[model samples]
Target: MQAEGRAPGVREVAAAAGVSRQTVSRVLNDHASIRPETRARVLAAMEELDFRPNRAARMLTTARSRTIGVLASSASSLFGPASSIDAVEDAAREVGYAVTVAHAASLEPFDLGAALDHLRAQAVEGVVVIAPQQRVQDAMAHLALTVPSVTLHGAGDAADEGVFVDQLRGARLATRHLLERGHRRIAHLAGPGDWSEARARREGFLAEMEAAGADAVVSREGDWTAASGAEIGAELVADASITAVFASNDQLALGVLHAARLAGRDVPGDLAVVGFDDIPEAAFFAPPLTTVRQEFAELGRRCVARLVALIEGGDLAFEEPVAPVLVVRESS
Candidate 1:
């Protein structure tokens, strides 16, 4: 066994296991031809000597950096994308890969092109695109990237291998929750039309309303911001018949909640409110918000896992959209 203080080399491990350094290297690299007994002996020797293969050296020799590129939205600091980034990093580390992030604040064609070029230059094995804007999807469609890539919150055309939370289902859940509470004249505060997630949510809400045979569906557009929610919420509150409102996301929901307070409407007793994305602050809202929760982290991990598998020439499967869960609380 090699001394504890001394870092063991390939040669030392090879000698201890009665195998050539080349054979040990091949085994460590997951080469299929090595005998089972030989591989086991080499692994045992490595354990005894506390030998750690130098990743940098191995990467240099194999021309495989074992690094993945993440093209996250510039607005990633916000709720959805930020949580996704964290999940991607966690999954990558668990699988023995490192992640490099690029913030493409704008989804313009030129910006996405430049971002892809930058990731290619970094020798990334795969890429996970985290932007879902129409412009971003258009930019991604134009890029001629040969590297394996997947997009989060993307439409079917974005990538054959990608993952997205079921925004439409979440919207339906929120609307259904409100309806079950006996709110007939419910309103929806939708996010911008350019975002795929927003569109999906809108579709879900409309579908649910149509199915329920509701008399009318009132809607207002928001920019997925607290201020937008507040502004639109005020309009919804102006109508005495509007007894419930569903905001597209938590920030906007918070704004709606504020607007409700400003309008002096008692929640649940006089009005019910539901939001999507169940962000951390949703629970702490003035009356504790009832919202739909999308597992942003799970979405990120799936994106990275699928892209990495594709990069490694492994099987890739398109999974159904992950379902959203409704968190019941005081607000609704």
Candidate 2:
């Protein structure tokens, strides 16, 4: 037993388990070479003694913090960013690494640099950047990062440096659904121009429209909010010639639905609408939304796998961008 009023250390646990100090350390670090039975024995010893390994002391000796840093923007309120953060945490834990997150104050280069600096000071072995905007990735490209990094939602601008859902393809799928429904004069409610996903979806909408030889009218950029969608949707429906609308996101699509109802236009009968990001509340929308779904959980797993590969100097195999699914509902 440990001395009165004192906790047992690694040395005591090693003695109790009849293993060397190095073996106990291996079990604590989850080293792959440790035998299953040996690992169990060490764990039992730890539980019996109530011994806790000090992470800082381990880092000092092993130089492995087993931490992955996340640089996030708009994570608190935004669904996509928030989901990505959660998925990343789950995946990292499965691989015996913890996550440290630093939110950027803004997309400015200085702010992003400061966030990265904060992560660096934490001794994170690698970083995953949830960059939804083109400028965020662009800004990070210029910054000097000693550790390996991966970006999300960067639209594949940096070769194999990021993991992302195929926004362009998903947008094309949404636009094509409208075209297939015989909507000739189609309108698009675009997200903000600065966002990479918005730009890709807008381009995809225009491209698909041109390919179908249909007349396409794109509204002024929106702020990815239902209010913005409602305002732009009101204008698009006013044209009377436009019979369908493709919104950049579910929130915007909800606004479009609101505008259509106020304008006395029945959805799919007067105006067919499609949206991206099949958020949880989408199916419960007034008419049930037909939208594109991005598998954020899969994207998160791939991001962690890719980043861990880079951090551990493993094979740098290229990962294909995750595909989005087109879900058809009453809205379209």
Candidate 3:
């Protein structure tokens, strides 16, 4: 057995194969000039020595770690972001790349800088920043990125090297669904005002309302938590004029459901509610939730495809963004 500190190195493998270290390196790197007999001998030597190439050493030679760094925020803990991250990991692995994630303490430049520094030390070929907040975006503008990087969920109108859920369209779908149900005095329970998705969703909600000529524009902000949702949900529907609600996320919608029940309001009878994300538990709610579904799996696949392109020097247009799907349930 190899000692922990004496793991087989390239020199050892080359010696065992009776070849020079350069020959071993070329064989490992698939240089294509090596003869098949020599390659087979090297492979047999590696199997005998159980040699694994040092990643750092390979990085120095090839200038490619073949790894991607993910600088994520609270999104990693949330359903949407977590699902997207899982998708990215799967997609990255499929394309023969490894993923390393660094969660920022906050999206502050200092925090983001620290995460970037960590990934750079690992010699990653590129980075994906899931900057959902404007503050993160603001800090990102001044930071110097040495490797190819792409921002996600933060780009404004311009279609850059990033991807975003079409929140505006999603919000419009939720709002229009309510409007079609004959809900005119509908109120919006939004996530943190600081989030791009939150702002886009709010904008979509208002746009749809105005387009439908619905005069009511009631709205309140929440922290994307059920507690915040419940607290604000109570106040949002207190006026009795609001017959329906469109929450920015499933948690907020759950809060609305709880609040309505506490107020003796029958869901979809006295007050209808809709949420976003279509989280796994959304359907299991007391009444299955009516909500907008962001294609997180697709979101992940595209980010990997885009970032890989950027890394490989390809300026490929990604497959178009998949629009959000509306899941109509008993809630709305």
Q: Write the per-residue lDDT of candidate 1 for residues 1-332, one digit (tens) a residue.
A: 65767789998999999999999999878899999999999999999988888877888878898888988766778788888888899989888788998887476777777878889887899988887677787778778987888788764444444488878788889988887887788888888888888888888888888888874455667988999999998888778898888888889888888888899888867888888988888889989999999887677667777878888899676557667899999988
Which scores better on TM-score, 2 or 3?
Answer: 2
lDDT of each: 0.83, 0.89, 0.85
**Alpha-carbon runs more than 4 Å astray in model 3:** 1-54
lDDT of 3 by residue, 159-242 (tens): 653376788889999999999989889999978888888998998999999999995555667889999889999997676889
lDDT by residue (26-86, candidate 2, tens digit) is 8887799999999999999999988977878899988999899999975336877888899
Query: TM-scores for all candidates?
Result: 0.86, 0.91, 0.85
How many residue pairs of model 2 clash at the backbone?
0
Better by lDDT, candidate 3 or 1: 3
Instruction: Spell out the clash pairs found in candidate 2.
Output: none
Candidate 2 residue 199 Cα shift, in angstroms, is: 0.8
lDDT of 1 at 312: 86
Winner by lDDT between candidate 3 and candidate 2 = 2
